[model samples]
Target: MKAQPIHTIRLILIPFTLEITKTLMAGDTSILQQLGLQLTPYWPDQEAIDTFPKIIHNLEKVPEPNGFESYMVVHRHSMTVIGDAGFKGLPNTEGEVDLGYAIITQAQKNGYGLEVAQGLVNWAFQQTNVKAVTARCLLANVASARVLERLGMQQVSSDAELIRWKLPKPVTQATIK
Candidate 1:
């Protein structure tokens, strides 16, 4: 069966040179504090790693990371780096990939995450091989889960603290006839 296009957001291809750009320019880290994500285990060495370097390093190497194709979420209006959304893992044996994202505190509840999530999924589908997209969120993270559902993903199951969601194989273009 042929794959289909199944998402509803516009996507742009940004080079790693942009997101991973490193310079002496002062950067804002307030988004971290605002989102309450600054201390997450994801960034375990908060002190030694340093904020700027961490982001640069993450951007620089994320595409080839063990399980992610990270991209920086930037505001088209203000042009500030807002948050991040990306595919979290390679296509599994079943041909599905995991999706994940986060928004700086101030950026939350404003529809950015939703747009980026949709856009990312749209872009993934354009890769022309992905059968589906899966997202796992903390059970208590209603907001995150809502992003997936609002994009038409359905709750598949849960394990412990994680809520798993799925976007079924897209309706193929051939099927549209």
Candidate 2:
């Protein structure tokens, strides 16, 4: 697959491509590790992710049905795996879409998170007939808020469990190059 270019007002974030598998079988662990990200499906090492079983279960289905997807975001110059960004489902009632992403710790300071995140959002809005994209972030995660804001999503509600933000419609469009 070719690289994709994402544009914001002052910066441009590039994407590596979309990759999905039951496990981190073929990807280079060291390279992904240097990017400050865990190739493991679950955030923290554990027995296993509850969702892992489902992911594996759905592997056989081509063009994954719904609420399932993944992608890698690569930095333009370095060509490094800066982060993993993608949506989980096609879309749900009320047009709510779930999104998840994380940048390697080493690549955190740069705007790659925002750039790639916006790219994901733009892609999602374009691919599906959805009205809005939603994400849940920890209230303390300022970095997450910053990234969401860059993608044109605003905080709409907050609860004890999560900080919710919604992207009504992506005004910025990016295409894979």
Candidate 3:
């Protein structure tokens, strides 16, 4: 079965089904029409294309999408695929799921990156197995850093080239009882 989409105010995040990924890898535009989404000129760019093998490998493990892989970021108003975002894989033993996202050049600076990242983090936190959501951005990527900060992720560590951020699940009254 296909995973249900995660809807935001201005975007709908559709998980990449095996068929969808395979079609996308093959450079077919029919998947867009089949999903009722319009295609942007820059979507499924080189990076997205390069990641297909891994996405496909991960999706193939389950009988269906289980909400732990890539999702195409669709603009709600235009119904166009602007980019992709999703968890790297299932939560680790430490219960952390890595997050990654990118908005196409045409869609950047419109706050879609933050909206989709926030949506993905929110969804991951709701999962019982996820204790925290983690992400890494290049040192020079100020935009991504700002988005992570806005999402309430604290800087946990950094190296010469990359900075890591993590957001832990908030404690609730129910959890303390």
Highest lDDT: give the candidate number: 3
**Clash number for every model?**
2, 6, 0
**Per-residue alpha-carbon lDDT of model 2 for 1-177, expressed as tens digits?**
132445545334433222333333443355446545445433322212334443344344434333235455555454444555556655677766778877767667877677667666766676546778889899888888888887778889998767898988644555322
10 residues in a row with least lDDT, candidate 2: 41-50
User: Roughly what TM-score does model 1 have, to 2 decimal places?
Assistant: 0.65
Which ten-residue region of model 3 has the weakest summed lDDT? Answer: 168-177
Per-residue lDDT of model 3, residues 29-145, tens digit only: 788988898867788888789888989998988888989899999999999888889988889999999999988887899999999999998888778888899999999999999
**TM-score versus the correct structure, for each prediction:** 0.65, 0.64, 0.95
Show where candidate 1 strays beyond 4 Å. Answer: 1-68, 175-177
In model 2, the runs with Cα more than 4 Å from the true position are: 1-20, 23-68, 170-177
Cα lDDT computed for each candidate against the true fold: 0.59, 0.58, 0.90
lDDT (Cα, 0-100) at 134 in candidate 1 = 90
Q: Using lDDT as the measure, what is the rank order of every candidate, best first?
A: 3, 1, 2
| Shift of residue 82 alpha carbon in model 3, Å | 0.4
